[model samples]
Target: MTGDLVTGLRSALSIRFVNTGTGPCTDMVFTVGLPPGIVLLGGTDRVVLPVLAAGRTHVHELTLQARTPGPFDLVCTNFSYRDENHEPVRVTGWRAGLSVRAAPVVAPVPQPTGRLGVICETPNLVLGAWDELRILVINDAGIPLEDVMMAVTGPFSGAVPRSRISVLGPGMMARFTFQVNVAEAGRHVPLTARTTYTSGGAVTRTQVDHLTVAAQPPVPPSPPPSSVPQSILYLAANPRDLPPLRSDEEMRRVKERLQLARNRDRYRIEPALAVRFDDISQSLVDHQPAVVHFSGHGDRDGNLGIEDNDGRCTKVTPEGLAALFSLHSRTLRCVILNACYSERLAWQLAPHVGHVVGMRSAIGDPAAIEFSVGFYLGLFDGHPVPDAFARGRAHLLSRPGLAPEHQTPVLFPPGPSW
Candidate 1:
């Protein structure tokens, strides 16, 4: 019986009849209909009834194929021959009730084309702290999603109105800006949302987003604008730059090799997904950074820096560096030169940014990666960058001897804040 209902399904069901009257009958009829919902599979009148002699008591067997899940009532009619007079008499009252959980064939969850991939930008948070976030929902599917409703909790824990996200059509993107104000900070806040999408019928889902907003220290605001706008920029010369390990094959092999050698996650590799430098926002350029990492070559004495093949100098000049400061973001604090000779060039622009890191000598790829790995782990993982720099510099320094010379970071003094 179970095999008859398809494999891996709870196919057994029973509907007992109070009476299956004995009869001198010609035929029996069973009638049924689904209780509700579209029938995924059974029918009421499906069983085959055998011919019955005047006093024969036999079973009418039914093998059902339920099309869907619902409650249903079955009716059985026993029609028999009459007493040698005129008409056939109806053998009354043969009915039963059934509850079928015929599971519908599960369809694959379609890829959200107008997908609003819910992501928690902050991985941790404190109570009473606020997290500024932009929700990115992209419609990458074939259909457009409208009137999307969701219940958001944790970071946005409040009885707020269902934020109506506008229509996101295929390949288009829509952003919703919301702030999660926390009463406390440093705790991991769970952002769970149940989205109700009305695609003719309805599909509901709950997804989780983890956020951490640490208790940020209170800081003083800038002492009134200087009336002049300052600007800065981070030019990643990597127009077509490939990350460590050269070609794609080589990179894959090396990553595999390294994974086997040691757990990079254990060592805390701050793997920043590489993006084109030009893709950087204009606003970011307007806000000068405390540190800047130039991942290319620079020469101070030559007053020249290398550029990508497209001719945008991978290497920037002092004037170019000054030009970088002209954007609007001039609160530059420190610079980490993942490039060669950048430290030497930073001597002239010393006051622009604090703490300059450059190769006192020519730096190779291995050393650059080593430093980046150490520095970011230290920065993002709660360790002060100075301590992280020391640790990284020590790792290379302890290697017995290699490189163009001692690959040390040149420190430039900070203008104000440390």
Candidate 2:
């Protein structure tokens, strides 16, 4: 009863009817009403069942061709048979016994049968720069192919390169070149390639080649600081008249993990808690820390909540935050907003800072704590900002039964040395 239907091709279907009565059946007429969009190959829809004994079955098989591209239902419209007493019985209104769907005009190409091969040649790639890559496609099936097309995709600035060949004989090959670039500095970036060709009157597609784009050595910062410990300014804001948070615990875990890092001696943690507007500016002017981290509540409008003069919840706009960072942009290398809906602020601050990390959405208490711990752990181990961001994300993912929202933090303006 199950078969495939293709455009402009005949498809066969079979249906069975059982006689469960205790007596034999005679002079039975079976009629199937075919919906529009399909035509019977034989131009007839009725079949005669001469006789059927008890506990027996009769199968009706036919071939149908689709005229247009759509689905149609086959229904049993008429059934007349003589019962055990030789009395005629009629049945109707049996609808939608089976469904047939015509294939689309452009059917999906079949998968390649291990007949093609691909090899990629790429040099060591640098961040925010372009490099040349070569791709070689081989016909390993020992057969000729026609209308062969190949394409290479990557995180380049614009559209990737593609090439085509009319014919590829047995043991033949083709080569294509692409200018690929990756804007971010990370351990790996995926590059993919796809090929489509015709072999023996069949259109086939080769599997995409998943390749990795590696970054070169990072550019050293201007007069990079020595191995001496760098200071990180930790700030928290919560109104005195409102509910309290686990901010103290989050900071403690971060310090604990930093102490356990391989290079524990390379960091100086500074705290400027219960932060107010003046406190943020004063700390930046006095401490001039390499990194600044804020842990507090944030609103949907991209505003961070800081304490007012009376220790009441006060929302600060992103513009104000960006302006404050701009004043001290020279000394501040990174800013981390460990608060909800901070991505909007992160985008605004990216231009004024070397590195920015913010949460895209609300994060759970445990997730926020784990992320901070992992981030500092990476910094204490001498990892760069991008690597540290990835380590923090990995830490959240590594936890058991963690929700997807826990991975909401995102890094911006990538490939910075900080």
Candidate 3:
């Protein structure tokens, strides 16, 4: 089940966030109007809110649990208090999941019945690498699927590999995958499985299984070093469990919710996108990646906030970062900062990275993540930076808390060297 709600509303919700004690504020709001019919209107009625703010962000976490499905029109705006000189001050906002359809519990997938055998297209008996394998899932049941989920578990305490699968249908299979690589190699290994399926937006059904992870062949030696060039490597790092500032006893309840609410196998939309934030320079260093993405909290000065293995945050200094990549032989094609106040980062990194792209003003977490995601996906679909930016803007502006005319992702073109 997806955990984010995104919509579009550029004409309303103009409430300025008054953080009487901060440097600047990033207050964004929006509204969404439903279409002809198809609205999320059923089952366990409850409202899910996605708001983004800094130290004072949680001020608006008031719960409105009664949710009714319908065509909802959302309005969002940024309210900034004018200075004594009437100067416009700035603050960063973290509006993530606003674009997500708040209540994902509604039956989006078709339903299924009887001994439904979900064929996984994922490879069998592959090499045991650090990364998990991708599996292609096809729903072979005759019925339309709805709210379908699955897991890969084992008997022992260590062999529990549980995860949820997204929308699947008759002849409308999804390429779902999961990895539970056994640290100790063996034969006929069992991967216990359990599934929960909502009957055509009504009832919930389940399934279970015991699978295997065949051993791998001997490690292959390095290939011959030809005169050819090196291929690019894309790395998405997730720092899910931010080392708790408090002890486990104090966070036992909070921690359990964290674990339950997560579909670890899938990319998540959280306070920040840990996937991109955890590994910033590694993007430029290891992969010599043609493109780099930094998604997290930031300030107007290009200062990025990142948590290390210990969950201790450190803002990367601009000049120091520029020099870090300078030692690398792999020249970059471009660098994207999908964090708040990333525009300032783009300007600072322009000279270091070959092509730079960032937002001129601060952006919400969800919008920033969506914007960057759309950009990369568009690239694979063959759109250039400027064109991709337009596509990104179209998607970002459509989210619930963003203004249709919001100035997002300020870009810096490729250098003369390109």
Question: On a 0 to 100 scale, what is the lDDT of residue 310 in model 3?
Answer: 63
Q: State the lDDT of candidate 3 residue by residue for 297-380, as single tens digits.
A: 566777666666665566676666666654552356566665566665565565445556776566654565556555554554
User: TM-score of model 3 relative to the true fold?
Assistant: 0.34
Q: Which regions of candidate 3 are displaced past 4 Å? A: 1-283, 404-406, 414-418
Pull out the clashing pairs in model 2: none
TM-score of each: 0.32, 0.47, 0.34
- Is 1 or 2 the stronger prediction by lDDT? 2
TM-score winner, 2 or 3: 2
Task: Specify the highest-TM-score model's number.
Answer: 2
Question: Candidate 1's C-alpha lDDT?
Answer: 0.46
Query: C-alpha displacement of 146 in model 2, angstroms?
Result: 35
Clashes of each: 58, 0, 45
Please give the RMSD to the true structure for each candidate, in Å: 20.4, 15.9, 33.5
